[model samples]
Target chain A: MKKILIGIIVVLLLAGCSGGEQVQSKPQDQGYVFNYNGIPIVVNTDVEPVLKELGEPLDYFEAESCAFQGLDKTYYYSGFELTTYPKDNTDYISSVYFMDDSVSTAEGIYIGSSVDDVLEAYGEDYTGGENAYIYTKGDSSLIIITENDEVISITYQALVEGLN
Target chain B: MKKILINITCIVLAVLFLAFLQKLFMPKYMSSIYEGNLIEEYYDSDKDHDVIFIGDCEVFSNVSPIVLWEKYGITSYIRGSAQQLVWQSYYLFEETLKYEKPDVVVFNVLAMKYNEPQKEAYNRLTLDGMKLSKSKIDAIRASMLEEESLITYLFPILRYHSRWSELTWEDFRYLFNKRKVSHNGYLMRSDTKPVTVVPEGRKLPDYSFGENAWYYLDKMTKLARENGIELMLIKSPSIYPYWYEEWDEQIAQYAKENDLLYVNFLPLADQMNIDYSKDTYDGGLHMNLAGAEKFTAYLGKILKENYNLEDRRGDTKLAAVWQDKVEFYEWMKQDQAMEMEKYGYLKSYGAAAQAIIN
Candidate 1:
């Protein structure tokens, strides 16, 4: 009776020990679901989640995330993939940055009304240090800045006529 | 005393239950089981295998163990892992010593993998395989769960016990329905078009004989030599030849200093009669089934002529098994060709399984 009682107690104790959140599968084991700023979104992969959560990416590539072959596809964030497409087809998200875990914004030019207007929009928070040069390559704005506080000259190049 | 008995009983029951559950739930025959045995079996068989291929996807996608086994009667097996490293090779050989021993061990070094960021957990998991026989409790403890073994064992739902929720109907049926393991074991696609990798001006890092990698290599060499086994370092064909050449120089220097045999096959792809554009399933890093067949056959001839290995085919106990496996391979080959045609290079599960046998 005592042995049986012990067995029952043991089983119950084992059972009691159970029940906790399963260790989230490794990042490469399956698709990912992420909450970006309280918005839940499912990204097909780690890379996708990172890109979606962070914003625009700098550069990325697909790779196996582990030493084993069983891992699902993972993306290597090399920065971001940013391009200014024509105004017709795609919505412009502007310059994007990509990372292994997430993507984020990088400091640079803005697209809209005028150069000084863009500077005022970013305000003093913009780290345009000494010798900072802002220019426009056609419709795209260009800005180059250095370490010490300096505002370099800004230039606006003309947009090519009938450019796609 | 009662409490002690209870703890002991719990551990034993937990272990047995875990074992039973693992057997019941796990895929009946996994690729690891086959790969684990394939190397030992070839080594044990009376027939001398022509070449022993090693490395990761670079080897499996490019070299067919079965083709080598069948064509040249070379009892070859691919001891490659997914993204194999020089360290894992050490453990594999360590484990392999328990059963059969091979004549030659080939090391297919990858170029991009030299500076890989290591994974501590995965390493611990693989290292656990080395400690399975001390006791059942020890075995459970030594598994991939590591510190989580107790929790996972008792609850199971902790790891795969509740895995039912994690899988789909397709996965459930496919896993439960399989009684036999059929596979070619190659996952990556073979490419033919040559790609270039020009490192932005970095001289090859000195891969001298004193580092951890060199220590493992030295140990492996000494182990093989002590066992009267030959060691060959072969570079699998790759699209990026520059990286291969760079590593090849380092490996060759190591070989020259250590008195080991080294062969560079990256630049020999065309010389081996591999059709660049079509024979490759990918653009070039790996080989397709067709490419693997050619490469394995060539490798087999090399082992036979150079190594003076004896092809002990008809007399080995594994002959019957090999014959059946070959028959399965033929079926899989036909199925794969059709599937590839239909799926257009994106192979299905069945095609993937068939690929291993091929």
Candidate 2:
């Protein structure tokens, strides 16, 4: 009877622990990092240091998060756009969207690059969608959207951790 | 025999106690985040409706059932919740069919963009109000995030036990009863925050709807067809979270192939007289009560023309019930207006009140 009671209590404790919200750990060494000028910006990491390093943005916008507290902010640069999601009163990089072909990914893949070029650079080990190919490394994903054999959009996104 | 009887009684009492605790611990969405209460409000309504609108915040905040009734005498209900996924909407529709069948089922296509389970808070907002059933079970299974467990949903006490420390009077007062937060599932916002600039949709990596989203949509279509209901797909005219042309084309193509009526109302905002400067409540994410009335007036006409629906105003019993709804609607509208007048913002509605309090 004592053993059975102890087992039940242990199970309940484990269940309680398992049910807790899972906070995604910040990527340390892995994940794709975009090099803007001399600064390197990584997704799922604190955006403050990167923003300070990158200087003033061309444009900025923020909206109260839908059905959640805090704000979703966007900063537009010359060739790319950086978006951040607020958590614990601090902003974390959510995504980096390439706007023009003037800038390329850290991997040398740019807009107007061929699908073959992407395969050559990033390799064939990617999840292929109808028009987009997603290459994931650790917590970050490099998505290249193609149309007519030419890449139209390239974006690096952090895998959303439950709530943003 | 006596020992067995005592043990049985104790077991029954223990079960009852846990159930009571579950009820008490549940978040009573009386003051804030009223969207959580929208789902259960459907149970109180007279279930005989000509149309059912199901989706996320887009349907609940954009469409007005009161306006539909007043203009065309068309009875309708919107079963919408915050960030409602496609599978959640499908199960909700399946559950709604168990109560009553509407002639037309309108599903907002915005939720199709999301392929996976979103925030757990959003899942709770949509699912907690739903009564325990096979549909709710299926919905919970389909909607649970990576961290969420089935047992937690089954026994809400397990999920909300920690909420004991945070329990307010609202929780205790609404332990057995919930306040009516929506009018036929429409969450009314009388205040306006006009659109300044409609942000362009960021270039998405994939424009194609996920296979999971398509699967549920196909299921929804089949379910509607089996019930002899016309499924109308709509893109509500909220300008933000920008609805892409590519997404629109795919839905349009699917609708064309399936012989369904697909309407993208964004471009027709001018015809609908939806002035973003006045119509939108939160920039461009959702429409205010004024906007919903205008949209509903336009939609009511189309629904009347296309669908085989009778203006149930002639039905004395239904009319009587709707009369009460109209009265309540008017009272709430006036009350909200009064609150706005006094506070310069709604004091009892949404995060505004919490902001003021803080």
Q: Which one is best on lDDT?
A: 2
Native A-B contact fraction in model 1 = 0.04
Per-residue accuracy of model 2 over A4-106 as CA lDDT, tens digit each: 5456444543565446444223444458989888789888889999998888999887766763357778898899999888766689888899999988988
lDDT of 1 at B115: 35
lDDT of candidate 2 at residue B239, scale 0 to 100: 88
Once fitted onto the true fold, the runs of candidate 1 whose alpha carbons sit more than 4 angstroms away are A1-164, B1-15, B23-51, B111-117, B120-164, B168-210, B240-244, B313-320, B350-358
Docking level for model 2: acceptable
CA deviation > 4 Å runs, candidate 2: A1-14, A23-30, A53-56, A113-121, A162-164, B351-358
Best by TM-score: 2
- Tens digits of per-residue lDDT, candidate 1, B128-172, equal 223342332332342322224444443433344444344444345
